[model samples]
Every structure is written in C-alpha cells, then in structure tokens.
Target chain A: MSSKAFKQPWTLRTASSVFVIAWLILAAFPFLWTLWGSFKVELDFFSKADWRNALTGARTMAEHGSSFTGNGYSGAWVQEEFWRAVFNTAIVCFFTVAISLTIGTLGGYALSRSSYRYTFWLLITALIFRAMPPITLVAGYLLPFFEWNLWGILPTTIVVLVAINQPFTLWMLHSFFQKIPKELDESAKVDGCTQFQAFRHVIIPVMWPGVITTGLFSFLLAYNDFAVTSMLLEKENQTMVPKIASFLGTTQTEGNVMFAVAAVVSATAPLFILVMFFQRQIVSGLTQGAVKG
Target chain B: MKHKTFFWFILPTALAMLLFIALPIVSVITQSLFTPHEQVFKTVENCTPFKCTQSTTIDQEATEALREAQPLGRFVGLSIYLDRGHLAFGEVAQAWQSRDGFGDFFNKIGNLPFYRAMAFTLSYTFVVTPLLIILGFMIAVAVNSLHRHLKGLVIFFSLLPMIVSPLIGSLVLFWMVDSRGVLGTGLQWLLSNPDLSLKASTGLTWIMLMVYGVWHSAPFAFVVFYAGLQTLPKDTLESAMIDGATRWQQIRYVVIPHLMPLVTFVALIQLMDNFRVFEPIVGFNAEAHAQSLSWFIFNDLGGETRLLSSASASSVLTILGVAILLSPVLIRTWRDFNSKG
Candidate 1:
C-alpha cells in the first residue's frame, strides 16, 4: 500500500520465481519424459546399443522411422488394448467413487445426527476396516471367491475396491459432519424441516465440499490401486497399469518407452479432468472438509 | 420419541456395517484360532486301513485323534490359537529359526530379497513421510499468506496430485526413472562416463522413488493443512502481527499451536497409511527390494499352501501395532465425542 515498500527492488520476487521454476522443473520432468517416451519406436529403442545410447539416441530414431512403421509410439497408443485398459480404469473409478460417496455420506449423516449405540459401534468398525490391510483381504478371499463362483471378474474387482474405499470415505465424511455445529441443525428444524428434510436440504449443501473431497479421494484410491486390481481382474478385464507392468518382462521389452509415455498421459488425465470440472468445489473441498475441527 | 427417531435414522448404516465391516472383522479374529490340524487328521483316518494294535498303539495317532475331537468352541479358545496356522505361535516358539511352517516359509523369509524388501519399505515410508509433511507445511503457509484469489489458486494446484489415480502416478514415476528416460538418462551419462555404476538399490533409482513419493503425497497434506490454517483465529494472528511478531514468531506462537490438533490428526492417518503402503512399491518396482507388512501378508496368503492362519496372525500383529500407535489419539477422540454428546 506504500511506495516505500515498493522502493526495495524486485529481488525477492525474482528469487521466488526462480525457486518455483526449479522445483517445477524437477517435479514435472518425469511427466515430460513419459509423454516423450510414449511417441518413440522399438527399433529406435534397441538400436542405441545400450541403455545410455538409447537414452541419448531415442530422438534420432523418431526422426528416421518409416511413415507407417507401426513399431513405436503409434503402435502402442492407437491399439485396442490401450483403449480397453482405459475403459476398465474408468469403469472401476466411476463405480467406486459413486458408491463410496453415497454410502459414506449416508453413514456419516446418520452418525452425525443419531445418538444410537450401534452408531458408535459402526464408527469403530468402519475405522478398523479403514485400517485393515487391503492386500490381505484381496489375497485371502479374492481367488477363493472366484473358485466358489461367488465372484466374477468385473463384479469381484468392483466389490473389493468398494470395500477397500468405503472405510476411508466414511471416516472422512463422519469427521466432516462432526464439524457442522448443532446450531445449524436446530435452525433447520426451526425453519419447519423434518429430520430427513433438514439433512437433505440443509446439511447436504453445507457438506458439498466434504462430499467432493471424499469422492475425489475414493476416485483416486480406486483408479490408482495396483495390487488389488492386479490380483482380482482376469485377463479380459485387466486394467491399464498392470497391463503396462506385464509388458516390462516380455520380449516386447522395448515397449517401456511407450509405457512411460502412456504413464504420463494416464496419470495427468484424471486429476486434470477433476480440477477442470470441479475447480471451485475441489479447492474448498480440499481445505475445509478433510482435517475436521 | 427422540430416541426412536435416532434409532430409525441410524438403522440402515448400522445394519450394513454390522453385516459387512463388523462381521468380517469378527470372522478374521475368530478364524485366527482354528487350525487345519483337524482336517489333516480326518483325511488321514479316511485314507489309512491300519487298525489299532493293542500293545503297539501309536501315540501320534492317538494324539491326532484327540486334536480332531477337540470342540470348535475350544478351537476358538487357547488350544485352537496355539496350533492355528502353518506358522503357529506354538511351533514358531519351539523352532530355533523363523521357519516353523510345514514347508518353505522359513526359506522364504531367509531369502535376502524379503528382508531387503522390508528394509526398502521401511526406509521409503520413513523418508517420504517427513518430506511430505514439511513440504505440505511450507505450501500451506505460503498459500495461507497469499491474497484470497491466489490462495485459492495455490490450493487448487496443490490438490492436483491427490486427484490422480495411484496407478497412474506409479507408472509415471517408473518411466521417468528408467535407465533410458529423462532423469535416468542424465544420471546414466554421469555414471558411465565417470566409470560409476548405478546400483539397483541406490544411485538414481532410489532418488527417483523418493521424488515420486514426495510429489504424489504432498498434495493431501497441503490441502488438509491449508484448511486447518483457515480455521485458525484471525484476530489472534492479527494481534500478533500488530505486536511486532515476525512471520516466524507468529507461526511459532500463533499458527503452530492452532494447528497441533490437526497436525496430529493428519499424522496419525498418514502413519497408518504409510505403515501399510503397497501401491507405490508394488507399482514402481514389483521386485525392487520394497516389501511392507501388507506385501508380505499377500505373498504368504497367495502361496500354494494358502496359509490363511499365518496371514491372520500377521494381520493381528499389524492391527495391534496400529492400535498401540494410535491408542492415545483414539482415546482422545472417543473422549471428545463423549463429552460433546
């Protein structure tokens, strides 16, 4: 607000910018490498004689490759399997987020408003499940369920994910609900709303950010899950990440370039899409909803 | 009437939780007791045609029959727990080495890879958590001090990492850290030209792992801290500023004290998560010496023997570890909830 404050040169400003730029470079480099690696060809990968040469000469191979070589970036990105993996990831994420949000919110609301014995029990149970090791649950039961015809690929994977995700969401939402003061409930009732009506009309709007954050977390957990998805899904329903992982040890070893590229693309897509669609809600959601007062 | 309404409202969630969460947990705890010793004895009895000899009676068979005849309720008691799994506590206590399982469980644990993996997992969590926390605090403070619009923007940008799928993050990290990729390539040249060898367990590989972890995890902590910062009393902070408190002074005296409750809360959740970490290690380098308790449990449970008992014992141990670590926090929260009620 004063000219005297501005009199000191822009040194701090410049330094801050430089710092931000350096960190961003380090942080964003892996993503850039992934994007570039996706467009590279296999022969180009192998021609370099060794790892170092391959690292340096990958660009050169890209330049000299045939128009429709079908050997490098083009082959991997444009394939049906790639699209299938993407679809499976979407299916898993969508259902996982949607179901997790519903159950968590409903349970959170009940626990928030109701003073019942089972509410405390439910909360504790949810906490225990939230802390349960995901690997043990999947390993011990997933295959056995399939063997006994209690599960199918898509359904089993979905249920396992839903179970894994529900506890965290419940805990998050419950905490969020706890933060909404009892005065708001009283005021809503005073405004002539029933208990259900009060929760639906009043509490829902207030907890929208919490819901969004919890939903986003659920989405992230489901989407990024490697071990559970790898264990549960049969060949046809195998998700994208594990498919790329499977590519690592095969004769198609040179496929690492495309895998890197795809990894960058895949990693950036969901978060980018989420922020783009729900920027406001996600921002406030992240801040006010998670660390309950 | 009030109690009735509350009961009705809580019923659906309580029922679903009981059947799913409560029942499964109780089953896991109960199943930790029953061994397959009975099943083995039954199979042996049906398979053999050997009849009892008067003077030369088989003590082993008689003991096996006694074990078989033991009640299932007693199985839920101490006896069942004693002989429960492939790696029973009873057997493990008797054996000199760790391998008390029927077959290769000892050899499996003896392998350098398993211990190396456990070390990796511990170090990864140990290293990443503090970095993430510090970065989160810096970002939170920076964002908290900005003008409203910019503060909002910073919060939005920081949450970007949290929203991405974990699968995607690990894959992205794998590519960047590969020998021929960006950072990997830079380091490869440095190593090769200088006659340096990049170790699988060290060199660029571990650095890549740490960076990936810090980048991916910082966002969650940042968002949570930022929110906590917002809820802090503005008047106290303003008064501190007016009283000639430096930013650091204000943070130490005003901000941190305000944030302790939340900091502890986030740390507890993160600790539980870090303790059971599976995704990054599993995704980044499946065979890369990175094994946490969760991964070990999976390996044991997935083996040919499917030693659910051993897995159960391990699970119980993990749960106990978590309970011990969080008992203070849990007790405090429970008390707070009760007082509020």
Candidate 2:
C-alpha cells in the first residue's frame, strides 16, 4: 500500500482526488438536496423570491415556524393516498421476484445440467427478449389484455414483469448453478436420490447467494417499472412511478408540488436502504453479469 | 437427467416467455400491418323550389359497429409504415423534388412523427453511451486509485443514482431544474440571464436529458470498470513503471486493452438502455420539445383514442433498430459459445 501510494506523483494524486471528490458530489448531492427540500414548503423549496431561500428554508420556517415540517409527507401519504401505491409496489416487487426466481431457477438449473443443443437456442431466445424494450411488449399487450379484461390489475403486470425479467434471471442463475459441480448431483443420484430430491436437497441451500442477488435485481425491475405499469394498470391501482408521473401531469397548480417531492423521497428510501445493506452483492452481481454475458 | 425431466424443468419459463415475450413480438408485427377502420360518412342532398341543400355527416353508430366487428381492422400491408406520420415517402419525395436545403428538408422531416423520434433516439443513444463510458471509467480509475476502505463508501453512494427508479431520478432532476427551482435559479443568476430556461428551448432540453442519462447510468459503468480494475496484472503495472510509463500512458497502453471486453459489455448494455430513453422525457415534461421512439408508442397508446396500430409500428421499428445495434454483440456471443464448446 505504501509503495503504491509513493508511485503516484503529487500532481496526479491531487488531480485524481479532485475528480473523485467532484464525482461523489455529483453522484450524491441531488438526492441529498431533494431529500432535505422534501420537508420544506413549496415556496421555500422552489423559492421564486430567492434561490438562497431554498437552502435557508426561509418559507418553511415562516410558514410552519420550523426549518422543516412534515406537511408534504402528510399531504401525499394521507391526503393523496400515496400509500396505496406503496402497497401496490410492495405486492408487485414481491410477486415478481418470487415468480421469476421460482421458474428461472428451474429453467436455469435444467439448462446448466443438460448437454442438449436446444438449450443453446433457448438461452439465445431469452437474450433477444431481454434486449427488446418492455414498452414494445406493452403495445401488443394493450389489445389482448384489454380484450381479455386482464389489463389494469397487479397480477397481470406481475406476470408481465416476471416474463420480461426471465432472460436475465435465467442467465444469472444458469451461470451460478453451473459453478456447483455436476458431481454433487451425480453423487446424490448414486445415493438413491431422485432428480427433484437432489435439487431440493443439494441445490436450494447452495443457490441462495446467486438467487438473492438475482432476486434483488428482480425487485428493482418491478419497483422501477414505469412503462408497463403505467400502460397496463388502472388509475386506482397505479404504482409509485405512474402515480408520481400523474402528479407531474396534473397537480402542480394546486400548490401540491411538495406532495410529489415527498412521494419521490418515500419511493427512493427503500433503494437507499437496499444499497446500504447489499452494496457488495449488488456490485458483484452487476459485474458478474456484464463481464460474463 | 432424462430429456423428459429436463423438458419439464424448462417448460414453465419457456411457456411464460412464449406467451408473453415471443407472442408479443408476433402480435406487434400483426398489429402493425392493420390500420384502424375509418369513420363511415354519408352525404345527403335535398332540392327545394329555390335552391338545393347538401350535408355530409359521420355515421358514428355504423363506424362503432364496424370497429366492433373487425377490431384488428383492414390489413394495409406496409402502407402504415410509409404514411405521412411514419416514413412519409410521398412528402419526402415532394421535399426532395422541391430542392429544399438540407436544413429545411430536415425541418420538414422533423414534422413527421417517426423521423423526429428516430432522430432524438439515435442521437441520445450515441451521445449518452460514450459520455457515460468515459465519465464512468474516469470515476472508476479515480476510485480504484484511492485507499481500499473508502471504496465501499464511494460505491454505496454511487449506486443511488443507478438504482433509483429512472422516473423518480428524472423527476428529482426535473424539479431541481425547473426555472424557479434551485439549479435553474442558480443558473439564471450565474449567467445573469433570467430568461435562461431548460423548458423554453430544444437544445437545452436535449442537453438536460443527456445530463440526466449520464448522471443515472454512469455508476453502473463505473462499478463494472472498477471491478475490472482490481484484476489488473500487478506484473504488467510494475513493468510499465520500470519502463518509465506515465500514469496516462500506463492507462492507455496497459489498462484499456485489458478493459476492452468490459467496455464492449457496458457499450452494448448502454445502447440498449439509452435507445429506450422514455421516462426522462415524461418526467421532465419535455415531450413537447423532445420525444423518443418509446415515448412515441406510449403517447399513442395513451389518451382516450388508443392508436394501437401506430404504436405497434413504432414498436416494430424500435425492435429492428435494436436488432441492428445488437447484431455485433450477438455474433460475438455466438462465436464465444462455439469456441468454448
């Protein structure tokens, strides 16, 4: 470490430090600023009077006799019923991860275990599906889903999310299951275990690390989904993203901009927490998929 | 495992993909060929002692019935692809025959929906991918250059932008960049021009969208490249130092070649992502000033009048564009698979 430090010249060290500091600031400052401003009244945050009022929280202090208040949170959560979206998002993310992982694990395990040639073509098809945007699928789903009266519910969107998520989940899990030696399964078979028993006993316990990582991604996919949920789900059943988009579309004039701000903060809170807990897994999962696939 | 067992294991996911993913492509292609039926119209004339009166009116009931009877409407083949809102072959020919200047021709082309969205989508994909890659690589190298302990902290913060919902991230940026919001107000003050607004101009809106794109996705690239950096050969670096290589030269000669595969990985993913730059346009409310192919489809399918045919056409075009961009990566993957086998 000492030798490495000495290799860097003073000029180069200063430049890199400057760049790193600037990048951290650029990366973090917007969310931090928005988070702070979410508690302020609209005038203070927006501050047509003076931009400095935003930092100072002048109007927030003036309006509520405090530097910050929960007016926005209350307005969005209680008044606007944004908690419905929170509930919907939870449901969507939960089922999307569960369903995708269940099917993806089986399919991926099969692909990894099999020496058949069609598995290659099957994986290739999944890759192509991954490359296609969800909005394109939404275009097709509109006609059929509407006709079948399946549009606008949580379940339909969940299935769609799981299906769209399959390619990545399958690939990730396939590679992960590949890492477990075939000898483990063969040995289990020699010990009088059926294939399902071999999988249930030998695979599931060892699969959690990869499964959890892939599950986290699936959760993000469902949670972050906007186009499909917006296009498919009904107004009453809108998720957080489409709900926030609706705020952008209609509600600025009612002086309810703070509601949107609070909602944005509320929605982003989980991701912030997710990163805090799973930084290592998330980073490794990302690079593992990229470098390999 | 027996073939039957393997088949059962893979069946559920294959069915899901077939019903949802594969079928959607087929349905989109089918939907694209057909146009919605036109409203039925009738003209009536009455002759009186002094003068004749005539009237034309839409038969709404008949039109509705027609629509109900044939929901997919009449198959127009490739006509929808070449109409004024899409390819606009006729209008383009007129523009060409009129010998309009390139700028004027482009302006006319921009009036076409498909061309306009294509222009933005292509430019956004090309511009954002490279910028994010360079910025991300710089951040990665800088972070890698630091002490190992600070790496975790920096990465935790970096993940925020990339992991946050793109819609939410864009909204956050959009609100901050509103003319009355902090960044916009600060910019106006710094420039001494109160009229400087992101929403008021085309170029500024595009720039803001690109800024949001880089701000959000660059972290993904950074994390990947940073991981790649850890595997850099110690012997090669020590040899470079012994040969009097500067930091820049070491990076250019040794680091980049090693990171090339990772670079392609990032590039492929970024092109696929940036090509579908839909949420930012919606979040920024910049649809009036800018649009993408994905946004075009969204707008058509939305509202009271669902233009299913138009949206499907846009979707097909977008898929084709992705296929074109993705072919190189696909071929490489195929070659790698074959070589390994």
Q: Report lDDT (Cα) of residue B114, candidate 1.
A: 35
List each model's interface RMSD. 3.6, 1.1
Q: What docking grade applies to model 1?
A: acceptable
Assess each prediction's global lDDT (C-alpha) against the native: 0.62, 0.90
lDDT of 2 at B240: 90
For model 1 chain B, the run of ten residues with the poorest summed lDDT: B39-48
C-alpha lDDT (0 to 100) for residue A133 of candidate 2: 86
By TM-score, the best candidate is 2
Q: Which residue segments of model 2 deviate by more than 4 Å?
A: A2-6, B41-65
Tens digit per residue, CA lDDT, model 2, A1-293: 44652367778879998999899888899999999999898888888778778878988898889898999999999988999999999999999999999999999999999987788888888888888889998888988898899989999999999999999899889888888999998899999998889999998888899999999999999999999999999998999999988877666475589999999999999999999999889998999876574
Q: In order, what DockQ does each candidate have?
A: 0.34, 0.80
What fraction of native interface contacts does model 2 preserve? Answer: 0.80
List model 2 lDDT by residue over B136-204, tens digit each.
999999898788898889999989999999999999999889998988988998999989999999999
How large is the interface RMSD of candidate 2?
1.1
